[model samples]
Target: MTAFRIALLATTVLPVLAVAQQMDPSMQMPGMGAGSTTEVAPPRTSAPAQAGMNGDHDMGAMRGTTSSLPRRVGAKRAAPSPAGPLASHNAGTMDGMGGIEAQREMPNPPPPPAALSGPAHAADLVYNPSDMATAREELRAEQGDLRAYRVLIDRLETQFQEGGNGYKWDAQAWYGSDINKLWLKSEGNGTYRGRVEEGDLQVLWSRAISPYFDLQAGGRVNFGPGPQRTDAVIALQALMPYSYNVEASLFLSNKGELRSRLEAEYDLLITQRLILQPRVELNLSAQNIRELGVGAGLSTVEAGLRLRYEFIPEFAPYVGIEYERKVGNTAGYARASGEDVGSFKYLVGLRSWF
Candidate 1:
């Protein structure tokens, strides 16, 4: 009877021991001695269970425990946290493992202040109103006091006209500020062999009458082949519309001769360095002056075309053709003097300015 009781106890206890061993290593079987606590710990509540209880997952805890689980051979594991414990802890309550990933991908905050980061402060970049006004007034005063001068040879050319090869020069020089100027003007023409035909010199006071026009009042002295004559002169010089340069003048001589002249010129640009200039001039008289070979009505008409190539802004060489005719009574006067009534000539010349 004792042996049978022992056998029954062995069978029952052996099965119970097998079941206890099969349980989780972290869980202690009931009725196991208290000393087994050292070998096996109480089973911890799973991270998901704790998350359900507290309404927030603990990602750090999950990451800490996931490494111990049995995994398939090719299963991908969660990436390790690079931000360490604090970020992982915050990520747990927010967006779980994805929140941790986001935290890792977050942009870093801007660095501390340094030179050239920005202006020191708003007030430091602002200018005082009074100071700005003072600076502007100084600039205006400087501009108002500015002065300039120019000397240009308006025409310095040799002409081949009906009579003979001749040279002509028309030049003006001025010194002043924008509003007023002292002007000196000179013009002359002479034969190629040194016989001066006619010439004049004038001194004028010029004032700006418009944006593109000047009014001049002056005295002129005519000198050359004919008897010298002094005259009172008034003239208008203008940059007309379409870029035309025009000048018109009237003269009252000491001997009571009345004469007027009109001249116009235009430059057409063929290229950056090539130009074609066309010019027209007309002369008229109120009464005939016998000694001077002048006529009562129309005196003369001249038209010319010149093509020049500029080597620089200040200088050019040109070839041109000119046609001149004595008109009305002037033609009769020319005929009586044995001079041609009309003529054409080809010319070459240099034009320059500074």
Candidate 2:
């Protein structure tokens, strides 16, 4: 029992003495007090989470150093976030746009014009006083043009008694008295002649095919001492101021007479109302006819001048003078030799149309 006690006391004293000797170094440091020294050991390295629990405060500070602070919670402030790439696009949306109305300085345009705008819009215009006169002048010019077009169309479609667009169709009746008639006076050396016979009445029908041509197919029935006669004719009438007419006809008499005749006329239009026409007629017998004044065969030529005044486009009254002559072998023997007839005839007639 005495040995065991001594061993225990020795063991306890030795450990206490070692601990006191180790702590003596702390007293020699600047901040350490005698017998009050408490040594603080350098902090141990640890994981980020373990550093907080371990009493190693330097580990937390080390994590927030300059290079690592941007990742840390409350160290250096974060760099400002960059603006989006599209933020500057709106500045150019209207940046280059210019103003409206850039054409005030153009050059040279004509003036003193007719209607500046159409009739449909004219009433809606608000003209300044300065422009009123010009507008009125232009309106007049436009109206004139309209009138001219209207007249042109009217002329093309309408017809007059004289001529209608070169087309004509009409029926005409004529009755006239010859004041003097030719009678065979002599059948002389080489030619036969005729004397003034008694007056006679002539009747016929006339028509026009166009302004430039005319046709007459009618009978001239003579009511006098001479045998009654009938004649059919076709004539071409020109429309120029100096008018010319040529005709061919078939002549027939009451005594079964058949012959052909050709006639021509020329007229001068001295005025719109007055016309002078000179007419010539020739006759030839088809078969031998010993009866009447036309012996065996007959050939007659007649000429006349007619002066007329047209009261209207369709109607005119004419007065004229005429002369006639006859020729044939039988005519020379039947009448006195070398006898010819010439006379001044007066005529009054109506020329009309529908």
Q: RMSD, model 2, all Cα superposed? A: 36.1
Error of 2 at 225 (Å): 4.1
Off by over 4 Å in 2: 1-171, 174-242, 252-256, 296-298, 311-319, 329-340, 346-354
Counting clashing residue pairs in each candidate, in order, gives: 1, 10
lDDT by residue for model 2 (1-354), tens? 999999999999878656644443323445544444343333344577454563523232432332211131212333422653333434434444322222444556886457554544454356664477677678766763222110011001111111111111112233321211111111111101233232222233444455555444444544334554543433333343446666565656666678765767776888989988787877777776654455445577778676778898666766655556676744564465444443333444444543
* Candidate 1 collision pairs: 162-343
Q: Which candidate gets the maximum lDDT versus the true structure?
A: 1
What RMSD does each model have against the real structure?
A: 18.3, 36.1
For model 1, residues 1-354, the per-residue Cα lDDT tens digits are 999999999999978656644554444346655345333223357888656654443443453343333333223345656775355355455547877788899999777766457654433458775676687678766786456778887677877765467888888888886778889999888998877789999999988999899999999998887898999999999998889999999999998889999999999999999999999999999998888888898899999998989999778888998888998888888899998888887878877777
- Give the distance in Å from residue 270's predicted Cα in candidate 1 to where it truly belongs: 1.0
- TM value for model 1: 0.60
Q: Judged by TM-score, which candidate is best?
A: 1
Look at candidate 1 and tell me the lDDT of residue 93.
Answer: 54
